[model samples]
Every structure is written in structure tokens, then in C-alpha cells.
Target: MASANATQSVYLDYAATTPTDPRVVEAMLPYFTEIYGNAHSGHRPGRRAEQAVEDARETVARILNCKPSEIVFTSGGTESVNLAIRGVTLSEKGDSAKHIVSSAIEHSAVLKTLEQMASTNGIEYTLLPVSQEAVVDPETLIPALQPNTALVSVMAANNEVGTIQPISALAAQAKARGVLMHTDAVQAAGQLPLDVQALGVDMLSLSAHKFYGPKGVGALYVRDGIRLTPSQTGGSHEEGQRAGTVNTPGVVGLAKALQLAYDEFDERTAHYRSLRDQLIDEVLRLVPNARLTGHSEQRLPGHASFLLDGLDGNTLIMHLDMKGLAASSASACKTGNPEPSSVLLAMGVPYETAFGSLRLTIGKDTTETDIEYSVSVLAQIVEKLYRLRQNYR
Candidate 1:
């Protein structure tokens, strides 16, 4: 049962960002106050900071099943993706290794970088189409591969609708033809079994904030033999692949958070799956002309998304906000895009339905009462929005 004086607003937008864990906070506090020195410095204080960074790297490497030297720390998922794509481009046999392949529903970080590279640097890219459920068939992607393709990038999970991709199979397929494979695993880091060896990807990216850690910290996993040119040229750092003073506190927080996530994976996953199922069932029962988005059973355990007729997602989200329920209409990164979702359009959803997208994701501590409250609140908001739209029509 919920406390009578408990919080009013339900945070159902974990896909956008999750609150930092308290254990992670405890782990980071020492780095900020006692060990406040740049990792680049060589003094005792700097060496302490550098040692903390290396410890964090080893922790992350343990989870990824990769060597500590293979992990490159960055600001976050966006910077990590930018580094991966650009680093590959710079290292590729110039002109000959100009082509790349990716999925259409990838995050803006991937899509935008590819666009910039293609337009400004003369790189060529092909985006494979997805099913209406926002999934890529390896067959579609394999056919688009070229002999000169430098890399093949795909997300482990779709941030908008939470569709899981077959990263292992896709990576195996891409590598068979000598192309390197990369996965934007930002959304899947804590939610899935993300063993790099099992996934077989040459590169992977993760953001700490997405899994209850501090913001402005993330890591990229580059396979042992794969070489990437430094994206940011500066003082040697991150094995000379990325350059900057390491963020000791944030990195420590990230490792602590990831450790907690793995330790509690089963229990947390069960809770999220139950709440997600409840959300889906209650919405379909209460709302008219509502259809679930993405693969019903294969999506992230915490993700619940839908499309409702005669409703715009932004408009619905506004009303939900007033009612103290938080949600999203599209990928959080593409919030202001008035156009229909690129992911939905790629999935072949009609413009009208795609325009009405709603995504609600639960987090590790989201209680049963919270899910109940959100479902009730969402039903009310959808009815209000439907009536308003009908009256206007």
C-alpha cells in the first residue's frame, strides 16, 4: 500500500532518465571531497585519482567481459556514439573504407553523426528498414553490407519503443564479411544480459545515468584487436583513443551503480515485467482505438508504449503532466520534433497513429501502487484528450 503522504507525481519516464542510486552516491562522495585531483596529474593526489579511475575501469570491464584497457570513458552516450562513429571513419582506409551500415530506428546520436559524416566527410551510409514492431531482420541488414564497409552499427534496444535487436546474430553476420560491428547499448545496459563476448560486437556504448548512476559519464567498449583513430586529439588519455582528465567521482558512481544492477537484476526485472504487463493490460481494456507498439513480448521488461486514435502524444502528455503523471511521446532526444517519429515512420505506422505515440517505462523502485496510479491517470487523460479532439473536429 502507498503511504497517504507519499509523492503525488509518478515518474514513468525511466527511458528518459533514471534517478541516481543512493549507494552510487555514497561511493562517489569520497572522490569529490577527499580525492579531488586531476587524473592527468602525477602527484600523490593525482595518482590516487588515477587509481580510482583504473579501479572503476576494471569494474566496468568485469561486466563487459573485456580488458580494462579496452574501455574508453566519455561524457555520455552521445559523446560515446560520436567517438565510435568518427573514430572508425578516421581510421578506415580513407576512400575505400567509406561506406557504413546501420538501422533506421537508431538514436539521434547515431543518425545525426552518420548524416554529418556522409555529408561533410564523403562517407556513405545505408540504414536498413525495420518491421512495424521496430525490429531489424538480419537478412535486410546483411544484404546491404558492402565489401568496403568500415562498420555496422545498431542499437541493442530501441529507446522509443524498447524493441530488442538480435545483436549477437547481427554482429556475427557482419564480422563474417570483415566489417566491424558496434552496438549502442545505452538502453540495454542494465535491462539485458549485456555480456560483450555473448553479444559478439566489436564495439559497444553505455551511459551510467540510464541505469541509476551519475550523469555526464559513460564508456565505450572497443574489442582488443580493433583499432580506432583518436576522435579528440589532445594529451594522451583513455589509451590515446580519447583525451581528457578522467571524471573520477562519476566513474566510481557508474561502477557502483552497475554492480548493484547486476546483483539485483532478477528481482528488479521481475517487478518491472509485472508492472509493465499491468500497464499494457489496463490501457488496452480502458482506452478505445488503442494499439500497443513494438513487439508485445520481446520488448524491454519495463517499457509500455501505445498509439491511440484521434490523439496527439504531445497533447496527451501535457494533460498527463497536469494530472501528476510523467511520460514521453517519442524518444526523449527527439522531444520537439513536430514531425511523426522517424522510428514509427520506419516501422510503417500511419502518420496519425504514429503522431499519438506514448511511452511509459518503470524503474527498479517503481512500486505497484505507482503503476496502478499511472494507469488510472492515463485512462482519464486519454478520455479527456479524445473528447477534446472530437469536439474540435
Candidate 2:
């Protein structure tokens, strides 16, 4: 029951979600209290609320370098992913375009949606394998595409291992084959460049909570000429793409948070990389048989995942929490599954090694002191566990 540092608690789970910025809260305040009119109503208050929604859409469009009309608001990353994949495949003209090509290490939102479609809608998909570094090779993706392939979906980065994928390269190949490309940018939204034109993707997904914005709000970027079947019907909201009353305050918060993140991107990433590298180096040096999981150089600045030999990942997480250091065994989406991470297994990690996985993602508030304390706590826990195992054996 000893505290990790005996001084303070450290949170290294930014990949799960981020603490919303106070500035974003400030921007969203008026919408909740004063401008609380329905966006679709034909009245003065409604007009004002509609303007605010449009303004927020414009802000998100500017960030993604897409037209405002191409952006559709959704509940969160899961909805965005579902919409992008299902909307396209279910369109009126989509009967002949049912096959999809994607990476094996995609987030479950993407994988599960595909599985659902395959079961009920006669959709077929190919999941390309990744390298040992957890990167999807563009060369491997080419053969996965078929004459009937409709879309190529891949994540901008690995949610669990933090490995950055070659999205541009993958999208380019899809484009050359006359196929549409989509990327789930939930994990990469605030930390990575999201210029849709540059990424060569026809559609991209974003979740506000990943970038210090409110939860329950996300956006899907579709190119101007792309056609999609409305996933949620009955209203003209989101240009008839989704049906529901617009979340004015949440959208305002999303825009403000994205603006602040990009404005401070250089400084924030430098801070994250500094602390992250220190933690990684110290943990590997101090703990025997510890191995870094993702691509060492191409991973997220704030992300560091690893495999600790001869330890259960969940057990390690419990010990870290007891010591006042918060972390994860894998993606928060798969928290209670009790199964080894599919991401690591897809990257060819042995099942036993995959069970020892640990993920520590630093955030804007992380510091050198926090990283130092986290490393000390993690090393001690691993050493103690190893000693106990030796004695038991």
C-alpha cells in the first residue's frame, strides 16, 4: 500500500482520454446558459444557435483543411468510425462495392463494424498484417485490394502500442487503385497533422475528448464529392447525415480545444517527447528483460508501451495504481476483456509476451518529475514481482 512517490499521484493514461482544457470550457459556457436554442428552429434564438454551430463547424473544417459542408458531427469516435465505414458501404450506389481492405491492428470500432457488415450485409474485408514494429506495410496492402473493393480504412496510429502508421502511403495506393480511403484519427487528432488533402484520405474521424475537448462529441470529414448513405435518418441535421438535436456546447468546446492544441503543438509535443523518452530509457535500463513495443522512432511523442518479461499486464497495472501511478494494460476500449491485446498479437508478439504489455502515455500536464517517479515505481514493482516469482519457483 506504499505510494509510488510518496509525494504525488501521476497519471500516464492520456491515450484513454484527456482532461478538458479550461479555455474550451470557457468557450462552451455561453452556449449552455444563454444560447440554448434548438439549432433547427426557425426563430431568433435558433438562428443564433445555428450560427454558433456553423462557426464551430468552420473551425473544425479549417483545422482539417476541408470544406465546412464536408464535416458531420457525431457522438464520438465510435460513431465517427461507424459512420465513415457504414455510410459509404451502404450508400445507394454501393451494391457493387462491398470489399474493404484495412490493417490487422485497427481499433475495434473499425474491426467490429466490418465484422457486423460482413455478417448481415454480405460485406467482405481483408485485414493486412503489420510488421514486428506494428506498422502496416503499404506493399502488403496493394494485394489486399480487389476489383470489387470499395474502401481502404486504416488508423492514423495504433491506439495501444502508439505506433504511427504510414497512412499517407496507404491512402495513396488506395487512391491509385480508384478506391476511397478513410482513416480513424481518434488517437492522432491533436498530436498529428490532419490535413485531409495531404493525408490523401476521402474520409477521416476525430474525437474531441482525445484533444482536451469535451467527450460525447466528434466529427467525420468526408470529401466534397464523396457520397454516403445517412446512417441516422429523419432530420436535416448534419445535412441529413445524422438525426438528432445538435450538441451546441460540446461542438463549441471541440472547436476551441482543437484551435488551442494546434496553436501550441510545437511546445506541447516537445514537452511530451522529453518526458516520454526519459521514462522509456529509465524503465528499460532499470528493469531486466523489458522490451519496447512499438516503433521506437515513429511512435507518438507521448506514448511508450512495453512488454515486461514474466509478469501479467493487468497485475502490473494494479501494482502501479496502488503505488499512485495510473497506467493501462492496453486500449481503454478493451479494458475488461481479459484477453491479450489483439494489436500486439497482430504484430507477431508471442501470446505470453503480449500478456505482459504495459502502456504509459504522457500528456500536456506530464513533467520530468512525474516521469522520474513513474520509472522508479515501475522498476521497483517489476523487480519485486520477479523476486517473488523466483522464490515461489
Candidate 3:
């Protein structure tokens, strides 16, 4: 295959996950060999581990502008999302509260948890609709809010289309109504500027792997004074919220990666935007019937999703891969799921168009040459697919 041609390989799937920065790995090296210790233990090694965990917490807090005591370590984004939504709704006082208001475009973590809550706990929920651009207006939540509403869970940015949500407006409305607000910021963690206080959200989720840190480690920020029932009951780790052995290196890596991200924010954002805009413009010009998804300007710096009317997204992905360009049809979470992306459907895209959704997210390492090659190959693939379909017809 041409993909094996070495020089042609281009990776454009940063939205799914990122390559862990070597600097983060260097920071974490000692934890596994020299500094290995259970964070919960009281001895010297344990105390050392505990100090690392606390330092990581402070680093994360510095970026989010939250208190260190408010951060809860977890496995990853899914676990953090579940803990934030379920932990609150299932709390002693929260059990009586019944409704949740969120957008149809939320990550499946938020949507599925709400679904389970509605089914098992008899809690009521409403999914606000999105525009054709796959964005939810903040005002949509005003009418959905009810006296029984307990929490409002939305994403700071979408996993599929990379649409930025009006978190401040949504959180402000929820706060005025005395309802709690939570956001799945896994996709937005390092790509966009995130300050929980500025966003007016009581809770937020961040994953290390989403921002050039290791996988299997993430954190949830719950505003100080907010109470949540423990998801896993046992040890008093994570302020008695989650129970498990702390991943010492993972914690250190998360902080180190986030610190690097904060330091390189402006430079990275500009680079990503340049590649993203170049790709979008070239694809629209080169491929027939191509339509861009999500808000044109409000989208993430590295995101450029699309719907090509006459081609199948999966087929296009395979063709791109054979040419040594890596991309995805949608969220990585939906891998092996045959159905079209629910995110595109929620945006009112036609069934056929949803099947053709293509997501190509750039990263800090992406280059001008990679963008040019991807566009050249993509145009050829789309043309070839159309010809094959016509021959079949």
C-alpha cells in the first residue's frame, strides 16, 4: 500500500487521542522505579507519592483556577463524566431532585449516563436540539429548565464536530435557577482557554491523553462546597470521592503536560488554526459536494469535520489510510459501532450525509507538507468513489 511508502504518513486524529509528550514521560520516569509508593500510605515513600499527587492537584488547579481540595483523580474522561453526573444525582439530597437539561450534541458519556439515570432512577431529562451547524444556543436551556431540575450537564466543546458551546451563558442561566452545572471539557482541555470560574460551571472533566499526557488518567474538578456521593466506596482517597490506588506517574504526567500546554497555548493554537483552515479550504475546493460541519469560526483550532455527499466516510478513511494519512469518521468511542454518528444526526444532517461525516483534527506537530498531501490524496479518493458509484449505477 502507498501508506507503507514511509514518507506519505500523516497523522490528523488528535481529537481521538494524542501522542504523550516525551517531557511528560521524563517527569513520570522516577515514579515507576525510584519513587514508587502508594499515595494513601503514611511512610516515607507513600508521603513522597502523596506530595506528588498534591503538587499535580495544585498544577491543575492553577490552570482551572480552582482549589486543590476540589480536584478528584479518576481513571479517565468516561469515569470522570460518570462520577460528576451520577455522583451528584445519586447523592443523599440529590436523589429527590429529578430533571437534567443538556444538549443533543453532548459526548456519549454525558448522554448515556443521563439515559441510565432516567431508566434506573426514574429521573427525568431533556436533550435540547442543535442547529444545522451542530451548535446549541444558550437560550434553548431556559425553556428546558424546570423546578425539578437538579443538574445541567453539557460539553465545553464537542468531540465529533468540535463546536464550542456557550458554557458561560448556559451555566449562568442554570446558576440563577439554583441548578448545578457540569461540563465535559475533555475535548477542550488544552485546545481552548478554560477557566471554570469564568465559565460559571460548578464541575468540569479533563483527560491527560487529550492534551499530550498519558492515558488511563484524568481528573474531575468539583467546585468547593459542592457535595457528591462517593462513586466507589472504600479508601478515603480523592477526598473520599473516588477509591483506588493513585497513579503517581500519571498524576505527575498530567500536571507536567498541562503546564506545558499553558506555556505553549498561543503558539500551538495559531499553528493548529493555520493547518485546519488550510485543510478545510482545500478540501472544499478539491472534493465535489463537500460540506463543512459545525460553526465556521467558533469551532476548535484544530478541527475540520465534513460531509461528502456521494462518498462513505469509512471508505474514505480506508483510502486515506492506504495513502498513509490517518483520520477518523467520528469519535473514537464509537469504534466498532456500525451506526452513523448520532452527533451529526442531532445536527439535522441528512441520514446519508451523516454516514459520510469525516473528522480530521490537526495537532502541534502537523506541518504544511502533511496538509498538502492529505488534500491531494483526498480529492483523488472522492473522485474515484464517485466514478465507482456511477459505474455501478
Error of 1 at 231 (Å): 2.2
Quote each prediction's TM-score.
0.97, 0.97, 0.97
Relative to the true structure, candidate 2 reaches a TM of 0.97
* Strongest candidate by lDDT: 2
Per-residue lDDT of candidate 2, residues 1-393 (tens digit): 223548468899999999999999999999998999998999999999999999999999998998999999999999999988999899835557989998899999999999999999999999999999999889998889998899999999888999999999999999999999999999998788899999999999999999999999999999988777877777778887888998999999999999998999999989989988988898889767789999999998889999986688888898888988889997887766688889989989888777888999999998788888888888888988889889999
Write the residue-wise lDDT of candidate 1 on 79-165 in tens digits.
899888889987987676899899999999999999999889999999999998988999887789887799999999999989999
lDDT of 3 by residue, 37-60 (tens): 898899999999999999999999
Query: Which ten residues in a row are the worst by lDDT in model 3?
Result: 1-10
Off by over 4 Å in 1: 1-7
* Backbone clashes under 3 angstroms, per model: 0, 1, 0
